[model samples]
Target: MKEKKSAKTYKPLQILAIGAHPDDVELCCAGTLARCIQRGDKVTIALACRGDSASMDLPGDKISSIRSREALHAARVLGAELIEMGMSDYGVDLTLQAKQVFSDVIRQTAPDVIFTHYHTDYGSDHNNTFVLVRDAALAATVGNFRTSRPAVSKSPLIYMWEPLAGYGFQPEIYVDITETFSRKVKMLNCHRSQREWFRRRGGVDFLDYIEVVAKFRGYQSGVRFAEGFIPLKNWANIGARSVLP
Candidate 1:
C-alpha cells in the first residue's frame, strides 16, 4: 500500500483591519473578517477617525460619542477588538506622528494580515489612511522606528479592501462570503447613527447601498455574496502562504 500524506495543519491568524471611519471596515470587508473569526482568528478593527462630522444635525462631540458606541457594538457583532485612534473626521493625515501611531498599533496587534482602504479611494481620510497603513507596516518592522511597543519581527501582509461603490478598484482576490453574509449585515447595522446620517445627507439607505454592492461583487466573483481584495505584494510584505480566510 502507498503511504498516505498527512493533512496540513494551519495556525490561527491575527488580523488587523484599519479603516478611515467607524463603519468603513464594516462597509468594505466585514464579510471577510467575519469568515476569519469563524476560522478561530483574532481580528482588530482600528479606525483612523471617530467620524465626528458624519451627522447632519448633531454636534461634533455628541456625534463622535454616538459613533464610538456604535463602533463598539459593531466590533462586538464581529467578535473583534476595536481601536479608536481618535483622529478628527476629515482630518486624517500622512504625518510622521500618524505613522508612528499606526506602527505602534501594528506592533501591539502583531497581525499576520492587514486590510485597509484602497489608495485612490474617495475622501482625504480614506486615501491618507491607506498611505499611513502602507508606510506603518514597514515602520513596524524597523527597530529604529521606535514606538510604545517593540518592533515586530516581520512585516505583515497587507490587502486593500474595495473602495466605496467599488470605484477604481480592481480586486485581485475574492472571498466568497455567502455563509457569513448575514453576519456582515448584522455588523454593518450596528452602526445605527450612520444609517440616519446617510438618509438625511444623501437620501441613501446605507444598508441597502451596501447590500447592493455586496451583490455586485458576488456577481463578479460568481458567489451568492462576496468581498474582494487587492494585495499590496511589496517585497517586505510578501509571503509564500495565503493569509486570507
Candidate 2:
C-alpha cells in the first residue's frame, strides 16, 4: 500500500502579507507563504517599516536602508515580491495617509488574500498596520478615495498572522507546516540584520521563536509544526471552487 497525498488545491493567489517590521512577515506568514508558493501561488510582502527601530546608535535613515535590503533578501528567499510602505518607524498611525499607502499596495498587488498583525499587539506599528491593511484590503476599490495606483480587485480575503503574543496571543486558523518548517527557518535566516540583532538577546538560538510558535500551532492542528492566522473578517470563501479547476 502507498501513503496518500494531501489535496493540492493549487490556486494562483495574488497574496499580500503586510508587516510593521521587516521580520514580522517572516515570523508571521513566511511558512504559509512558502507553502502557497510551493502550491503555485504568487505571493507578495509589504513591510510597513524597514525595522530601523532595532538600532539606536545608527541613524534612522541609515538603518532603514539596511533593513529594507534585508527585507528584500528575505522576501526573495521566500520567493515573494517585496514592497515597503516607508511609513515612519514607530510613526505608524491609523491615519488617512497610512491608508493611502495601504490603498496603493492593495491596488497594485490585488491580493487574493491579505495577511497582517493580529488585532491584539504590543506596538503601535503592529496595531496600525492591521488597521490600514484591513481597511485598505476592502477600500482599495473605491476610486473616490483616490490612490495613485491603479485600482485592482475589491474585497480580498484578509487574515491576521501571529501577534508575538507574549501578551496572551491566540489564533483562529492554524496551518500545518511540519513539512515547511525548515523553509520558514530559511526565510528568517535571510534577514541578516535581524539575525545579528537577535543575537544580542541570545543569538542564532533565539531564532527558534518562529519554529516554537509553528510547532505549538502545528500541535493544535495535529502536525509537527505550523503557522496560525486569524481572518480579519469573520468568514471567507474557502473551498476548491476558489481554486482554478
Candidate 3:
C-alpha cells in the first residue's frame, strides 16, 4: 500500500499591532504578541504618537525621547519591530495625511493580521487611531491611493484589542496567554517611565492593573490568562482561515 501523506504546513505570518501611545500595545496585547512570537511568527508594534504629554514634570521633547526609549525596550522584550509615526500626543486624526502615513506603514509591513484600538474607546486619540487604521487598511489595497509604498494586493484582517478597563467593549475572541503572561509583564515593565508617571499621578500600580485585567479575561475564557479581541467583521476584513496564534 502507498504511504499516507502528512498534512500540509504553512509558513510563519507577519503581524502588525498599532496603538495610540508608546505603551498602549504592551498594556493591551503584549501577551498575545508574545504568544505569536513563540510560534515563530513575526510581529511589529506601531505607535501613532510618542506620548509627549504623558509626563507632568518633563517637557514635551524630553518625555518624547524617554518614551521612545522605553518603547524600544518593550519592543525588544516582545521580539517585535517598532514603528513610530511621530504624531503629537492628542493629535491623531482622520485627516488625509494621517491616512496616507498609516497606509504607507501597512503597505511596507504587509501584515497578515492587524491589532488596533477599538472604535468606542475612551480617549479621542484612541478613537481616531481606530478610524485611521480602519481606513488605511482599506486604502492600502486601492491602487490609486498613492502612498510612499506600493499598494498591497489584499487587505489584512483587523482585530481590536480590549479597551481601557475593558470599558464599553465585549470581546468576540480570546487568546490564552497563560504561558506567555510573564513575558507580557516583562514587556510592560520596560515602560519604566509610564510606571512612575502612573504612580505619581494616579497612585496606580500599573503592573497590578494589568494583572487584574488579564485575570478577569482569563476567568471569562476559562484560561489562566488571556487577551480579548474583536474582529472587524466587514466583508473585506474577514477571512476563512484562523490566523491568531
Point to the candidate with the largest lDDT.
Answer: 3
In the order shown, what is each candidate's alpha-carbon RMSD?
1.8, 4.8, 1.2
Stretches > 4 Å off in candidate 2: 1-10, 201-205, 234-245
Candidates in order, TM-scores: namely 0.96, 0.87, 0.97
Tell me the spans in candidate 1 whose CA falls farther than 4 Å from its real position: 1-5
Q: How far off is model 1, as Cα RMSD?
A: 1.8
What C-alpha lDDT, on a 0 to 100 scale, does residue 39 get in candidate 1? 92
**Residues 1-245, candidate 1, lDDT per residue (tens digit)?**
99887987768999999999999999999999999999999999999898989887889999999999999999999999999999998889878999999999999999999999998888999999999998999999999998899999978899999888788887889999999989888987888889888888888987898789878889999998888899997897778888787
Estimate the overall C-alpha local distance difference test score of candidate 1: 0.91
Q: Tens digits of per-residue lDDT for model 3 on 1-245? A: 99887986768899999999999999999999998998889999999998999998999999999999999999998889999999999899789999999999999899999999999888999999999998999999999999888899888999999888888888889999999999989988889999999999989987999899999999999999989999999977999888887
The Cα local distance difference test for each model comes to 0.91, 0.77, 0.92
The residue-by-residue lDDT of candidate 2 on 147-184, one tens digit each, is 89876655777777777743566676777676777877
C-alpha lDDT of residue 86 in model 3: 96
Candidate 2 has an lDDT of 0.77
